[model samples]
Target: MQPTEGERRTRLTIGVVAARSGRLAKLGDPLTFVTEHLRRRLRHVVGQGGRYELELVSRDSRSDPEVARRVTEELIRHERADIIVTLAGTRVLPAVADVCEALATPCVTSAFPWQVHYFGRGATRTRPFSWTYHFCWGLDDIAAVFAEMWAVLGAERRVGCLWNDGPQGNWSRHRERGFLPAAAARGHFLVDPGGYREPATAFDDHITAFRDADVEIITSAATGADLARFRHQAARRGLRPRLITCSRWLAYPVDGTGADDPAEAKVASLVYWTPRHPYRSSFDGMPAADLAAAYERATGRQWLQPLGLAHALFEVAVHALATADDPTQARAVAAAIGRTRLETVAGPLDWTTGPVPNVATVRLAGGQWKRGTRHPHELAVVSNSHCPGLRLEADLEFLH
Candidate 1:
């Protein structure tokens, strides 16, 4: 039921944090798009019903931990946010989660896989965090998509993994906890040189380990800069794998953009949400293709995967806010978000049947980047075995 004009106005202040500047700023583009789309949806729905007014207090994580913590503190202490939403990965998400949990605030997040989130970081599945909620594909989905891509490309099953101590990297490198089992289930063994620390200035030891193991395939869950460095260093050290699939090199500030070497032309990664997806916006039912084209037209840049996922973030947030018995109450909003089963522009998100509570997921497809005429290179869906109905737009192609 819509809140009537006679009813009191709910001042729903939302806290939004994203890595808007710094080394990781590239991943924060979704913050801009999410803000725009959320406002549009709110305006469309606010007066028509849910008579509450929306106020967003956005903060830039700056891709730094201390910066993220400080900004979140400001939002909660000064701005008085009713709920919070986090974007991107690693340093920022954990900081926001920690603060929100401490304050007993409802914090919703997307764009990062769940395995690297709270429960994925070694928390037991039986123990559910009350204040935070996440919706994204995890290691299980990535492994399935990668295995399906490998089979489609007819690549060798012997795979090598390079990951860092960070969220995605930690999950990828931990043998029992992550990729090893996912690959092992598909009859592929992952040669892990263990997790490495960033800014280490060298990866020669890791490169040699993969080469020594005769690894025919390479997979990683490193940052964009690290992935590029890994590829460059691997080539110089003569560690050329038949196929290289990665977890985090699929979007802007990286991905196929500004990539000079042909080495980057052949790599592939999991596609959580792409312009080719058949999903649409929950608010106005805007199609994925139209959304991408419009984003490119507005931003004068390539449409990214984060754009869709970020849009989904707001979709989930808005739904939770509107459904809450008391939008002004943090506890009610948190519980409402945990009960999310909304269809988003990215895909269907159901938090009920989680590997852990307060976590939901979307289907993942495999995509490869290559030079094309339409743009720098079109990201064609190369594998969709795990994601039914998402047709394969191109066969897997690798550099020799």
Candidate 2:
């Protein structure tokens, strides 16, 4: 049956998913966060514009590719989602990408760029087809930043890489192809003693291997809970090295309080970035907190990581819709997005080529865990290659 115009109002839904694994029990999941944020932002944008509607559907990928594909099919065919936002790293992104192409809908994702590349071939002639828009920083850019930081610190020699053996691990392995050779050319000894799992049942063997390598610098790609557990274990066993980790480390609240032992505090200085925190003081202005609070007020639970990404996703959707000449056409909306630049609470976001979106600049800063504060040593931007408007140090305050 063909539906009337009024009946189509509720058809626009957004789908979200998270891993349902025991390993991620402590750190809040990303799916929940994205869902709540999307709902909140949709309400705010709708209230002001009164155009489209937003719906949140939850799926559990368990990091499995098949599960991801099934969930995406359900969302597109059953839920009638106008747009889909999938949190990065789940097996679901590729599945959703394929479906979005078949359905001609747009899918915005927050995941490692390399994962997108590994999942399949190009969908778009101009960009990767399947109408996928990436919001996360690319691994190549991350590796380059790490290399730059190592050079600045004068600790470019004796580098060791460690990552969990999964999609992220596989991506890191590819990243090392470029990272190692770059470091080697700079007079550094790069070593891959193999990756380790987080919340690992055993670490004695991994610890022994790291010690034997006598590595001065270690780059880690781990989530908050995993990194915390590994750091705690490393501290307890006196396994200390200058550690460099991915930006995911900043996604969680990192107070030294999370560490059981006081000795862990000593190694905190080794963390890297542009020597400044990425978060802006204006984060308080971000609609995410307001949305989270509203969700709590109604549902009595706080939103988490994935929800944050969802909120950003919805904001992007709203921007695209507002600027779009015709919101109902998927191609038109995608065209608008390509032509527009979104000013988001996370920073100014725009899409570019590569397997993943390129981050023209990284807001670098560092922080330390201090009493009562989750982040100390607040981050300040040392450089931003992409953000031409933010070249001066004083202009960085605008990021807040």
Candidate 3:
């Protein structure tokens, strides 16, 4: 099946891997959804005069780290990937960071907070040497949003925090350091009931303790179906505390159904970058209706927050590559990203990082479930700082 002598081929291979456990179904699952969206976007970009080849390698990391490392190595060394994009958290980041560093290639990771420092720190130190970019929010930003939510609810005096016990969870631990003391100084009590792993079948046990402690609010670092189950179980048992959740939670469907829930429904979420409602914005220029239509036509599904974020990331990446003299060079791409200021669906993004007087730039906004709508209750700008680094603390209490 080889082509004749004069046939020319220009191939640019990019590798993508997901660290989350299990195989992907066509719809519903977060990893699958993200991966498919990325694939579609990549194809569209390529079709629009961008020549590149993209391949996705799915791996199961639940069993062993060495297995994940081996998969990464194969992609880089054997597959000869020009760039490696990982949708894994700490599990894969630490394993591949050194390899990418040694090889002097770019590694773009879509990880939560705990892994941010691993990638961010790596990116900062190895800049122009080995390029690393994190496409997720920061932990400090999460903490700040929690503080603001508690303050807004007038529950600043006492707060409780709950997180999973993994790489993402570890980032929550670091965030508490900055968040708890800030709350305490504001005459609030900070409570950490350790960390709980996902598939939390022991709902009764956790709720009992929070109830006993008279915890007014409970903030969680969990997301997707886990958050829905947590809320449903708590509500059924009458353990409704004021609820605050991480940005990941915000991406879930508001009603626990595909459509939006009623406005009276209660499920508070913290997010980075303001959510694009069906409204107008001068910065992006793309009207809400136009963006929604474009997204629906492109993906064959209604647009949501996560889709918006993914689209924005893809747009930025395309822009960076399009304007580069050598699009395949990792260093050139990184430099382009850092220097270019582009408008995206997620609003304006300045990729450059540096210490400034006002490091607490607003990153996380808040949202709630609307009882009966396709979108979550219109997202609101709560805190003016990034939610990832903020010590997030809030409780979900149902009002019956």
Using TM-score as the measure, the top candidate is 1
Scored by CA lDDT, what does every candidate get?
0.77, 0.51, 0.52
Model 2, 1-400: lDDT tens digits are 3368765432345566455553332222545554554455454223223565555676766566677677777776777665666654534566666666677777776544443343333433345453656665445555555555555447555666666666555565664433345456567676776767654655566566667877656666665566666656766787776544444554433444535322233222212222121422122454444544554565454333334444556566666656666665677667665654655544556664333332212223322222322223223333345333333232111100
lDDT of 3 by residue, 1-400 (tens): 2336765334555555444553211112334455564564455224224575544444444424466577667777776655655544444555655556567665554434533444334343334333555455456556555666667657554666666776565555554333344446566576676667776755666666777777767777665556556666767777777544444556544444431242344556655433343333332356445655665676666455544444444455566566655665667765665564555555555555522210112244555544434543444443444433323223333444
Report each candidate's C-alpha RMSD, comma-separated, in the order given: 3.6, 6.7, 6.9
Q: Ten residues in a row with the worst lDDT in model 2? A: 391-400
Off by over 4 Å in 2: 4-11, 18-67, 90-92, 111-127, 148-155, 175-187, 197-209, 223-239, 242-248, 254-308, 352-371, 374-400
Q: After superposition, how far is residue 267 of candidate 3 from its true place, in Å?
A: 1.5
Looking at model 2, residue 56 earns an lDDT score of 65
Q: Tens-digit lDDT track for model 1 on 277-322?
A: 8898887798888888888888888888888887877788878888
**In model 2, how large is the Cα lDDT of residue 261?**
22
Clashing pairs in 1: none
Ranking by TM-score: 1, 2, 3
TM-score of each candidate structure, all chains considered together: 0.91, 0.68, 0.67
